[model samples]
Target: MDKHNYKSYRIEAENICVDYHGKVALYDANLRLKAGQICGLVGMNGAGKTTFFNALTGFVNISKGKIRINGESLRIAQKYQAIAYVPQSEGIDSQFPVSVWDVVMMGRYGSMNILRSPRESDIQAVKDAIDRVDLMELSSTPIGNLSGGQRKRTFLARAIAQRASILLLDEPFAGVDIRTEKLISELFIQFKNEGKTILLSTHDMIHVREFCDLVLLINKTVVAYGETSEVFTPENITSTFGGMSPDVLLGPES
Candidate 1:
């Protein structure tokens, strides 16, 4: 764990490359995001959006280059649980024997002892997170019984309870309703106000434009990245997704 300081950039990746066996998933990838920012990670399917997130979390082997979170090396940052990740809803099994409270409490495991016991502070954190997500009424509900939006909020509560400086969210808006979308959008702004850096991948360009001031566009590699106003254009979208307009992806199934 190198104690290197990366200034104000809460998340930074330099010349990263990911190889799945002999197949290269990502190459020549680079990104830097400052604290108090929301960045939309947009790319085509199988274009390495998840691969980039995995590289940052050290869930995948980085074939080359480095990533830093909170100005420290990714390995060290990850060791301290510096980043909180909320993966796509499809990855989680709702049939598991877990309550909303049970899932939120998992966030505190990183701070607990070998027995994984929860302290008063941990309990309070979980409660506060659940409250923030307005899920106190359903806190005791089994995950399998929750609706799509409630399930999404439960996982978001988990991330909130983790209290990490950086958050990586994959398609948070995928299965949510209009009210849930509004809640999430508000939460993003609140997180930014708290100086928490967030990077979320979404196929919907409308949400990206409405929620993020910055955007990172990816194809096989990062084609363009910067302020959304400048980088998110017809030409860049055309380059990244190959002739698909931003409107075509706004459908519910896209």
Candidate 2:
């Protein structure tokens, strides 16, 4: 990939810093995500992954730096319509009387006017998203009733429906079964093929190695960021994760 392709810079962060209350979550964190690529943000628990996501999505105010999309300065409105954030927890309330289809349609609320209801095209988009995630059978079912893996798929479908060029997914594969993980990996590939930029925070190093074109190792600050194979070295992994090697941590499954 051309390192300085301005057109490919879907998302760019310059010295981003965030503090929650009195605690610093991220300090001088910088990253750039190009189009048609899947970049993995890997770090241990409490490594400021979600904090960085919140900062990028404008859900949390940053103390320093600027985040831009397509070379334009980022705004909350830009974040709403141009960026899709899939958090670790499925935000859908299982007990709520909302169907999976309805949940997916909610993603379009950012673009919908107050006076207008969902158009046929909007409905079609929702259907297409559900189909993409293989959640068509459960489209009419309650989201709360689905298993953990199914819940992840549902949120991914919601992101797809949003039609965002930049997708930020946090721990999307956590609690998911092997099959579901594979399916999500394939979905990432599909997104890449469509020229979408995906930034996912995950603990699955093996998956990162296999699927991600780039990897950013972050722990409050960016330790390393580059091609997966080059950045995920034994020395780099050990430094990032306190001496735990991939073979010991991920094992043969990796």
Candidate 3:
């Protein structure tokens, strides 16, 4: 695709509504995330951050509204193939008997036919992703033996191997150390420079301010969505977090 054409790889949600058992998790949320932007999702627990991501990634059925990717409206099933999601590491069973290599290759399964084995290119992609995340030394290690940061990097490598235009991450920085967090932050910037779109949910306002270009504040609905600087003000954050001040949440540096 032409560079100009590729720039249109944006995500548009029109009045998105998600409900569970008659309870609204997301209500009439509408937002447009442009290509190559890293959008940070912020809201209190139970305020619908994960719910919005689930609806956007098609993990849950939306009660009402529509989503368009690159100008084409798509159903939930179709959206799955169009985006890559790296859910929280806690969701993975650390005891699962899988090697780092095996875990990363799962990302390629979506592109393969049923009952087919990985081809040479798939193997190479997995290797490249591992190397990108500086996991070559641990590539053969079992996932159960890896540290929390290593496990997070392993999943990030998997997402990179998927090569999707849109990436969704939930709490990626949760258990990571400062160095690993910096590495992941740099990787996100690299993805952005390569024209990929990213939406990540995080509670750390500091990282949100430092890493994300855009911010999506949700409190059962979209309280604000725009450039990080504009949407992360004390007023908007207070609207979503309730009783919290931006200075206290973001700290002095932010």
What residue pairs are clashing in model 3? none
After superposing candidate 2 on the true structure, give the runs of residues whose Cα lies further than 4 Å from its correct spot.
1-6, 76-80, 90-93, 244-247, 252-254
The digit string of per-residue lDDT tens for model 1 on 1-254 reads 24444667899899999999899999989999988999999999999999999998889988888887877887788778789999898979989989999999998888889998899999999999999999999999999999888889998999999999899999999989888888899999899999999999998888888988899999879989999999988788878897777456554532
- Candidate 3 — which residues are off by over 4 angstroms? 1-9, 75-80, 252-254
Native-vs-model 2 lDDT?
0.84
TM per candidate comes to 0.94, 0.91, 0.92
**Which ranges of candidate 1 are over 4 A from the true structure?**
1-5, 245-254
Which prediction has more favorable lDDT, 2 or 3?
3
- Give lDDT per model, in order: 0.89, 0.84, 0.86
lDDT of 3 by residue, 1-254 (tens): 66555347478888999999998888999877777889999899999888888887778988899877766655643535568888897777999999999999988888877965999999999999999999999999999999999999999999888887888899999988777898898998899999888999999888888889989998998888899887788899877888787778777864
Clashes of each: 0, 1, 0
Show pairs that collide, candidate 1.
none
In candidate 3, position 143 carries an lDDT of 95
44-115 in candidate 2: lDDT tens per residue?
787898888999888899999988787666774374578888868644455778888888998887878895
Candidate with maximal TM-score: 1
